[model samples]
Target: MLRSVLAVALLCWGADGAVTCRNENDEPVNWYILYKAPHLTSQALTGLEYVYIDSNVMRKMAPSTDNYKDIKHPNGVLANTLRPLLTPIRSMPNNFGFISYSDQPPGCNAMDTFGHSKGVVMVDNSGPGVWLLHSTPQFPFRRDQNHFWPESGARNAQIFICVTLGYSQFSHIGMHLQYIGAFPFEHDIPLDFHQELRDAVNWVKSPPPNNLRKLISTDVNQPFYSIAKQQSEQPKVGDLYVTIAQLLDSDLQVQTWGCQRDRKPSYCVSGIHKVLNIKDIHTVLGNWQPKHDHSKWCVAENPNNHWTCIADVNRATTQYQRRGGALCFQNQRIKRIFLQVAQGTDDCSTLNIMDTIDCEPDPHTPSLMG
Candidate 1:
């Protein structure tokens, strides 16, 4: 049964014509440049917040990518050029409030300290959360090499996300990076991407406490900790525990879409299907509402089943006069990149990138390139 109870709005949600949110017009909220959540009206729905940095600023600090132009592999293979491109990273560049380390393999590995898989370097700075950096043999044919971020310099194409537990800035709930898939490498970014990142960051920083209480606010009053524990304990593949150390990879595209809303807020869980040591509740998006019916969404686990929550993906949407990476493509033509933290949902439609791109698997092609 759907329960109607008082709750917070942790995600930037939109109603038919309006939305209630915090920081609607605050100057601090103006710090970001992507999308903006409508100012929240209820104090209970104010735990959402987030931020996106310029990855290009960080790219500039790294040795010039052009230096690898003359670089060649031992076998004189064109792919060998990928090595020189990475050689500049022998020492990680410092930019922003983050300190990065480029351990590019073969040396004392500090990145593997977190029980990560072999060959995979961990990107952990004195920031929000630890990220997995896997340099596939696809580019540079090397192992044991990893890069750490430094504090200082510009935030080029890579933006790091810092998630918090409450209003307190001291507590870090989680952290992730929203790598600008197109910008610095190509030199342009969509205005909407910047706006979306800006808006997302704001929501993440000041999340609605209701998101936390929603799952735990029941007859049993079970907290998120318990729910997560229950999900983790259900059953998992041993290989998945080691996937974080494996090369970065993705599954093939499947087409589907739909929308749904429940009187009670719902959640969407993300996980690895084994063979990789990377696993966790990536994000918990909240307070979703869609114009279409819930029947438009589909689930990865159950194709016939409907989906209510939308995974934070590489969106190719655009907003006129907006400035940022997401807006580069006027019609939303970005690759499926990083995942956004999940939020609670009232209604939502699950749209897949393949459906729009016609299931063409190619990261090299950038339609909304920067």
Candidate 2:
């Protein structure tokens, strides 16, 4: 399938004067943005964080992006999928960041015959990985960046989902699956945005399903945890040069994409391709996935940022799958872990395993010395 798509991409080459570009099956294509710089920055990080925690921001930019018409409602689907995730973040009082897209509304005119002839889309080498946002408003794509978001007492925190796309000829699917990074962002206390960002990126870039899941599940047994925990515990948000220097030492690379390769600034016809550290930036930009959810961790440095914590958490989740399962999980090296909790019945009351509650005494000293 990818071979066929590549053939089409070859034909669509801007040099060929193909006018309009399409997949092998000839479906109208949309430009997809897979990675953004700094991996975690003020605009990409704080902007989305503010929107997610604030209802006003959520209303204006929850799924912020330019809406296109030709694609029949791409924005709607994309925005809806992300709305739930952003709402909580926007509601936070201190969060901040911005939202934007590479493609304009009604999809872009690949023929280079309409508004912004510079608009274009690109798919990953794999095959429909995931769909984060569409280029159009009906289903626009947006980003969040909160490098210093504070969480005094919070649960059910936000998780980041990074995806890669591949085009298909049979279904005329213009995107394929390459990689998925599912990273949960939480702090031990006194939140450190930079550290969480580093952990999230490294977790996504780590290697596969087990590694990625282990990052979010807080599974101690996972191989990447030692490094992730260590870095996450370190300092973030300090002197710019100092932070950048520290990031480079860890293996993050800074790259620029979405421009011309001909020694000129040209719009990326196949989207953008660059690398950077996973920690430096806030937003998790990239292509969206469709049906499959494949997540894992690999030891690769992202040229889009400057730090090296590339863990992924893509397990192809259906709307149904996300709703089920225990909310809190931890990874343990032990093969089996047993716990004692209360079970539930008619009215609901207890700390049994079935009940899903804990009756253990609070470890902290009495608040009022009771």
State each model's CA lDDT, in order.
Answer: 0.18, 0.20
Per residue, candidate 1 scores C-alpha lDDT tens digits across 69-160 of 21122311111111112233323222101112221222222221111111111111222111112211121223212322111101111121
RMSD in Å for all candidates: 22.3, 23.9
RMSD of 2: 23.9
Q: Which digits, one per residue and each the tens of the lDDT, describe model 2 over residues 292-359?
A: 01111112123332222222111111111111010111222110110000011111121112111221
| Per-candidate TM-score against the hidden true structure | 0.19, 0.18
**Error in Å for residue 66 of model 1:** 13
Model number with the top TM-score = 1
Report model 2's TM-score to 2 decimal places. 0.18
Runs in model 2 deviating more than 4 A are 1-77, 80-126, 131-163, 166-229, 236-245, 248-370
CA displacement after TM-score superposition, residue 276 of candidate 1 (Å): 12
